[model samples]
Target: MSEPAAPADTIPHGDPFAIFEDWFAEARVTEPNDPNAMALATATPDGRPSVRMVLLKGHGPDGFVFYTNFESRKGHELAANGHVALLFHWKSLRRQIRIEGPISEVTPAEADAYFASRHPESRLGSAASDQSRPLENRQVYLDRVAAVRALYPDGNVPRPAHWSGYCVRPEAIEFWHDREFRLHERRRFVQSADGGWTSTMLYP
Candidate 1:
């Protein structure tokens, strides 16, 4: 399917955050699964980069939030390099968002709260799985999960100290909309030194 015709108003709002929220809400209705999914990009100590799909669990004026184990590979990368980038592509909507910013961990209390909200099995799995680590066999992970289940038989799993959330306080945000004749529309809002956004339209 092709992209819809561009509306008269192509200029995103003065606040990129608000524009993001509007598109996100639209995607929620259009996307088949995990509408808030995004590609998280992180870099190793030597500048080698990696990208993986992750859910965008929260976003607002505070910034974009996602949760994971602090001991994971991405977590370690964020620790070593505070700079991070993210991309959100909604296939159904034929739109995308690119964001770059400094990453920081969310509060421990916030992590605990989000952890508590997850299903019992998910919480247990997250606690048992050694993310980004090599395992000898599948049984090793299953055994660990079984052990975790036994330790918390009642399914009241506690958030592991290593698991938490991070928020990206964006310094640059770009919104892209597909257009006919291969001339897509791209607009970027960069954070200015004065604590405001400078909007610019880029050539497709």
Candidate 2:
């Protein structure tokens, strides 16, 4: 008979970045929609917290990236305090990852390049919206979109200065997996002072 596979809780101690990539790739295959979607958590300098969903545009040793209008609530919050947290839950796979970090803005050139890669309609919508601000009516926003379309008939929309991306440089990462009979498994990795990772198992 073949030997049984190792338990999920028995995750090997290794490079956390490599482990994250492996799990993310599996999520991409199994998730029915927006596998890159993650919850971003930010706080005011005074300590109130807010969270919302955002798409993961990129990731590597540097960190995870996502774009938004710099004038938005998240923008304001991040400007005041760079500390942030991210959560990814793959329902189909019964797995979750938590990340905590400080963020930094991407270069203007990088923002422009990503903006150019978006669909023309998406570009127009982004350029026109005063994100996170109260609007008088839906028609007002539609009219703004129409105005942008008229100005960029050739679909050559220049990126707005207020629109850009931020990268979160993680200080810690934790992975959780659902197991039989509610015996979940949790593994956390904390960046060490000497630039290595320390892994620990948490009761679940």
Best by lDDT: 2
Cα lDDT of model 2 by residue, 140-192, tens digit: 99999999999988989999999999999999999898887888898999999
Query: What's every prediction's RMSD, in angstroms?
Result: 3.0, 2.1
Error of 2 at 1 (Å): 15
Model 2, residue 153: C-alpha shift (Å): 1.0
Per-residue lDDT over 1-204 for candidate 1, one digit per residue giving the tens place of the 0 to 100 score: 997766844756689988998899999999999998899999987999999988888888678999998888988898899888999999898899999999888999999999999999999899998899898999999999999999999999999999999999999999998876767889999988988899888887
Runs of candidate 2 exceeding 4 Å displacement: 1-8
TM-scores of the models, in the given order?
A: 0.94, 0.95
Q: Which ten contiguous residues of candidate 2 have the minimum total lDDT?
A: 3-12
The per-model lDDT (C-alpha) reads 0.90, 0.94
lDDT of 2 at 113: 92
The CA-based lDDT of model 1 is what?
0.90
